[model samples]
Target chain A: MHEFAIARSLVDAAIDVARNAGVSRITRIRCRIGDLQQVDGDLLGDAFSAVCDGTVCEAADLCIERTHMAFDCERCGTTFLVGEWDWSCPGCGESGSHARGGDELELIGIDGELNDGNQSAPKCV
Target chain B: MMEIKVLRNVFEKNDRAAEQNRELFDRRHITCINLLGGAGSGKTAMLESIVPILSQSLRVGVLEGDLATTRDAERIAALNVPVVQLLTNGGCHLNATLVQHGLEALMQHELDLVIIENVGNPICPANFDLGEHLRMSVLSVTEGDDKPQKYPLLFKAVQAVLITKCDLLPFVDFDIERAKADIRRLNPTAAILRTSSQRGIGIEDVADWLRQIVNERQSLVAAP
Candidate 1:
């Protein structure tokens, strides 16, 4: 349902990265979305193509990297990854453990060929 | 051609607007909370029970955000509390921009606590920050215990979790312990409170928590 806005933002980001790199066309866009975010892959895919109309990323490939929520124990300082929704700290049974590396929504990088007919890959900081 | 590197966040614009809202609330010494949950989570009912009780001690106002209808606002108005309703039409969630508008309309009256009842949806509302000091989620026992598991984003971002409709716990198959465990697993720090707006169960506790939050915010501001 809200995938339309997310798709628009993703495409907008890819186009910005591509245009700045002097690439006339986009080959692929890589992203990392967390499992906790509850994003539907199919809906995002559909929205991406629809929102990319007339944009530089019209034919770009979207690659998604998925990760589960991970938490670190506050008392014993133990770190573990959780597959299910339960987020208890594995070490000391204490709550309020800090979360690590889930809930990410980022455009990691873009891959495309330059207008001069040479394949180019721009590295992002 | 020269390349201009841009690493802009997709939600940077919304975050900026939310920051402005935070600044405004801080300046006014108002404690704002964004109440989120699925439809029929007892949001309006919970407010109906708490506002009058809280008003005895503090000045309170509400900004009801919904897709259509001013029904919720009308409910609060019956209690004689200052409230404004923002109609989103077909939008799924209420963003910071809409809330900023709501604040302007609500500021006509002096309010100590401003609770924004967001549109009833678990997923979309998690993405938009309405410039609130805290986010509280309402979960009714009838909505199943796995709701926290199903929508982790709402649970993860919320400052506290309120379990509503507790009066029916004897009739239904709701697992209170399991639901608490599930929420703890997702959000270790979220304060869990159980209540039933129908029976006035734990309403005072909820009111006490709200007062503590307001007092804490005041102390934080008064700190050097």
Candidate 2:
């Protein structure tokens, strides 16, 4: 349900970048998602296809890169990775209030081709 | 064949809208809170109990989000305060854009505190920020104590957790201490309060907490 809204945003972002780069076709759109998002990639992919219809990103591939949750203990200063909902620091047994990473939900980049140029080099926009 | 690095957040649009909402709230000197919970978690009941107490000192407003019904708004309206019903149709969550519209409608009244009753799913609503000063979630005894572990995202995102329907705790197998421990594991700073709307327990405490927040905001606005 809400994935449709997120997918629409992703498509809109891709189209915005493509139009700015003067690209006619988009090959792929890559996203980095964190564990906190709890999004279903399959559902998001389906939603992306549905929302991208007739748009510049209609044929684009949605590549989702999932990032795991990481935490830094404030008590012992031990940085540790959370396997699944485990927030306690294994070193000092203190529950950390500080999070180090893994809450990312960003559009990393896009792969596309220019309309006027035959140069196939990847444009890092 | 070329890959360009965009490096933009997927929630950038929503986050930008939320910032705009925050600016509006700050400019108006209003303290907004997003109330999140499951469908039958007694969120409306808790509001029903607290709004009266809150309205005695502070001007309060409510924006009710539901899939299709205006029933929650009706409940809040019975308290004789400013209330708006937002129908999401079938959307699982309420986004910042919707909250901006809700604020626009609610801003007509001079409210000190505005509580947005988000759509009743624990998962999807946790992912979106509605530009609230405080985020609180209601969990009922019958919903089971393990819910905090199952829905860690929601528990982790909230600033407070209201354990509602405590009157039924005698019959239910809800382990309050265990639930509190689990919630603390996820969010060390979240305030956990036990409340029973039917018995009028802990309603004043919630109201007093909100009042403190409103007074703080008022002082900040009054300051240079």
Top DockQ hit: 2
lDDT of each: 0.84, 0.85
Q: Which prediction has the highest lDDT against the true structure?
A: 2
Chain B only, TM-score of each candidate: 0.95, 0.97
Docking class of 2: medium
lDDT of 1 by residue, B189-212 (tens): 889999999999999999999999
Model 2 lDDT tens row, B1-224? 56688898887889899999988989889999999999999999989999999899889999999999888899999999999999888989999999888877899999889999999998889878889999999999999988876777888877889999999998999999878877876787888999999998898888887888889989989999
Which pairs clash (backbone N, Cα, C closer than 3 Å) in model 1? A87-B185, A88-B185, A96-B188
Candidate 1 TM-score for chain A: 0.81
**Candidate 2 chain B lowest-lDDT run of ten:** B148-157
The local lDDT score (0 to 100) that residue A104 gets in candidate 1 is 78
